[model samples]
Target: MAHIMITGGSSGIGLQIARLLVQRGERVSLLARDPAKLEAAKHALQSQYPDSRPVHIQAVDVTDGAALHAAVMDCVASQGAIDTLIASAGMIVPGSFLDQTAGDFNSQIDTNLIGVANAIRAVYPSMIAAGRGTITIISSGAALLGIPGYTAYCASKYGLRGLATALRLEAKPKGVSVCICFPPDTDTPQFRQEIAQRGPETKRFLGPPKPWPVETVAKHIVKGMDAGKGEIFFGFDMMMLDKLGPIIRPILEKAYERRNKKHIGAQEGR
Candidate 1:
């Protein structure tokens, strides 16, 4: 049986991935903060697989390095080394440049960027020792296309993309594959909450409609992880943006200006 460790497996895309992996008979270990939610997710998985491989939960914040390392070590020891590690823990707190605080940006960088780094640091040595493993980092469409009001979210996700690129180069000789995923607007609670935060004018600034069910994105990610892909940009407009990166930037910038104009008008009316 393949042993897999997934951070943020308690909910959303991570939870979906965990459920699918467990259904496929993989030994799944969850690293998440909420014990109750984690237990609930585990129960849901167990309901589907009564004879499923072990589903262990390590309830701890991904931002906590020492604790994260301990949790990884414990999982690795128990599972006889993880065959795969998915750094899927992430969040979004959207705001325009003027409305956001230093804390807002820092918190995202700490969780979205440093969180991935910490998990990789904790998992890589064991994977290297085993001489085989795959690491999947969950980025976002914002990493490729800049959204009008989501400066911090885009920056942190871009950092994840960069980290994945570098790690790919580093792990090549060790037979370890690193995969970076760029998923579009997922129908997760976080996306719904961010859209709800939008003012009338800025709501349009969210850019394009959300598409693809959460399960579809999760399946695509699993396929990429299994194939040892360097990076997988999933979803509709996101793939186009990545393909058109050279010409897409200037076009997106102009579009964002128009979107900002609407926001400015809304603010003036207020």
Candidate 2:
């Protein structure tokens, strides 16, 4: 059993992954901003996997580099070396580019992009010194295409792709494997929050969000990690896009524009 640490593991896909890993006899550590949620998560995991190793929980905002580094060190000290580090912490604020404030954009960047980088940096030295480790980054389908209302989210996730690609090149030679997972709209607390603030054009274009369950997403991610795959695509459509994103982007953009125009026309008629 490996020692695994996951950021944002207090809930959603991150929590599910932690639970699954613990069930498989792995020692797991969870890091998030909320102490209450982290305690609750630990209780839930302990109840479900009574025979498993104790779950290590750390309350640290991913955006705070110093706090995050300290939290990571604590986990390593408690659980021994981290064999797997999953940088799953992220945030999203969707709106038209003009409507979204600069603060909103920067917040997403700090959490979704830079936060991941910081988490990686904290664990990287240990992994490199050990000469073996697995790093999984949770990018989104938004990384593939810039949707109508997810401009900032798209930018951050796209930046994650770049980070993973470059890191993979450097780490692969050193026995550290980097995997980036592109999960589509996932059924989580975060998704519910996004739904509450979704723009009409985005809602129409994406069509009544059918998010995949946390269990399903976690299953695929763990399987991919086991196989040591570099890129993990959750859905069939996502896989297709990963392969042909540039080729099909123009077509997708035209379709979205047509849909937006129709939605506007209907709104105007009303």
Q: What C-alpha lDDT do the candidate models reach, one value each?
A: 0.85, 0.93
Best by TM-score: 2
Measured with C-alpha atoms, the lDDT of residue 247 in candidate 1 is 98
**TM-score per candidate, chains pooled:** 0.92, 0.97
State the lDDT of candidate 2 residue by residue for 1-270, as single tens digits. Answer: 799999999999999999889999999999999999999999999998899999999999999999999999999899999999999999989898999999998999999999999999999988999999999999999999888889899999999999999999999999899999999889999999989999887887788888999899999999999998999997678888888988888888888889878878988999
Residue 262 of model 2 has an lDDT of 86
lDDT per residue, candidate 1, 50-149, as tens digits? 9888789889888899999999988877776888889999978778878889998788888899998999999899789888899999998889866756
Candidate 2 is scored at a TM of 0.97
* Poorest 10 consecutive residues by lDDT, candidate 2: 200-209
Worst 10 residues of 1 by lDDT: 199-208
Candidate 1 wrong stretches, greater than 4 Å: 199-202, 259-270
Error of 2 at 105 (Å): 1.2
